[model samples]
Target: MGDWFQTIVDVQATPQEAETLAADVRSWLISSGIVSAEPTHCVLGADVGHPPGPRAETAVDPSGWSVPWHDGLAITVGRTVFDAGQGDPMAVTCPHCSTTTHLADERFELKYEVWEPFREVVRGWDEGDDIVIACPACTQPVEPTSWRWTDDYFVLAYLGFTFWNWPPLRPQFVDDLARHLADHRTVLLEGKL
Candidate 1:
């Protein structure tokens, strides 16, 4: 019978430092009379997207694994091996697209937190606009769907989200979470939509 809240903080820190910051924030919440919060259970490494840009790595054989670059290029796994008499660089399969084009890493890591809002008159809120939703699978824009309570907890959903990852911290993810919570709040708590 109360509104729920989820916050996502994206940071570039070591896992230990990140955990410390999360714990500190949680403690601060409790001290400030915010609802009790918990850190996400795990960290996930995933590729966000790759836009067309200047080439960063030479295309080489796909025999080895590819690595990501921040500028949207993936470095070939190994140095280019030229044929006995040719100068054309070898081609590799793009991991994200599977095309015969050169492949790159373009991957990043993210963390998620699930906070439970357990009381009436949820307070200390901010408006969310200019939110961006990107598909975890395709990295395309997605619409927010709904949120549901599950296993005595709340989870957010998007077009491609699963129970494995819920309550995405971005505005788009939050919108999806809000929709999920509204749709299944009754079912989650009462067994019916």
Candidate 2:
């Protein structure tokens, strides 16, 4: 089976503040006994990451499995594009008129004509270009980051915390983490890779 991961992305963290916020959040996690202070090669797609600490169970839902199957937390800092690691997003909902534009057809095939525009803009966004796409429905300019993707399939952020193969994290735990993130808006993106 493929490895599963859940990433909590700080959507509002600016590029300049990302490193500091990542360090602060990492410290909080370590102090809370959610992860170890030392980094190890326990995470996927990274050279090192903090492993589960003594009180790791405190971060997960009590009703769910508490034993971790794989690795631990990997904090990514910088301009990056994070997704479900599966495929293209099925659709995107514009924040302007609450209009959802479908990127896939009835047969679950990606509609390149519709997805191409988003793809180009997302690429530019990842490259540190401030780009906005006009809503196909409302004809209003909208930042790609403000648009919600299906299943949180796209997260363009400066900072992200990836937890690999851990049990379902408690909602309270996520909230606490967000508080440590200077109360910035966060998004959870989960999928198997």
Candidate 3:
């Protein structure tokens, strides 16, 4: 199985905007010294995978995915996540009983207050939305604001960036990125490998 621990942040923007944002992020990485000078560039095309470097694999594969980016230490920007795998939702705290349990945990039974949002983006999340889950311990409804739905990544619509082997991005980073892109509607998505 592919074993990439990806941290993806989806930006809400158009294709043109996404391209611009990607370039800006690349420059930021270089200027911030997170990436060294003379980093290489590569086009991710075919072979159903993006190899870890500038050279593209010529082997024929059917994943039908392609994009371009600077190798390593920079975020990969794209319109769609493309072949993103699902993971368990971030752990949630039961507000009714103050019991903490993962959303995917069997011990915590979830009752979707509004199932539509969860259905539309089963593997996606946004911080602005209210948490719609019940507490497992007390079997009572919990205030959405009292629960925390934290995770490694979140998937937003319109645009996205993939960070490989990087530190978890802070809230300020997302806010700043959206500010730079002029797209405040962003979300995080965790893609399982």
What are the Cα lDDT values of the candidates?
0.24, 0.89, 0.44
TM-score of 1: 0.19
- When superposed on Cα atoms, how far off is each prediction in RMSD? 23.8, 1.6, 10.5
lDDT of 1 by residue, 43-67 (tens): 1221431221222122112234243
How well does candidate 3 match the true structure in TM-score terms?
Answer: 0.42
* Residue 142 CA displacement from its true place in model 2, Å: 1.5
Query: Which residue pairs in candidate 1 have backbone atoms (N, alpha carbon, C) closer than 3 angstroms, thus clashing?
Result: 67-105, 68-105, 68-106, 74-104, 146-179, 146-180, 147-179, 147-180, 147-181
Worst 10 residues of 3 by lDDT: 53-62
Rank list by lDDT: 2, 3, 1
lDDT by residue for model 3 over 1-193, one digit each (tens)? 3333334354345546667776775565455554444544422222222223222121112143343323343345443333345554445555467676554436544435433333334233233343454556677765432343445223334455544432344556556556656655555543546
Task: List the candidates' TM-scores in order.
Answer: 0.19, 0.94, 0.42
- TM-score winner: 2
Model 2 TM-score, 2 decimals: 0.94
Per-residue lDDT, model 2, residue 36, is: 94
lDDT: worst 10-residue window of model 2: 61-70
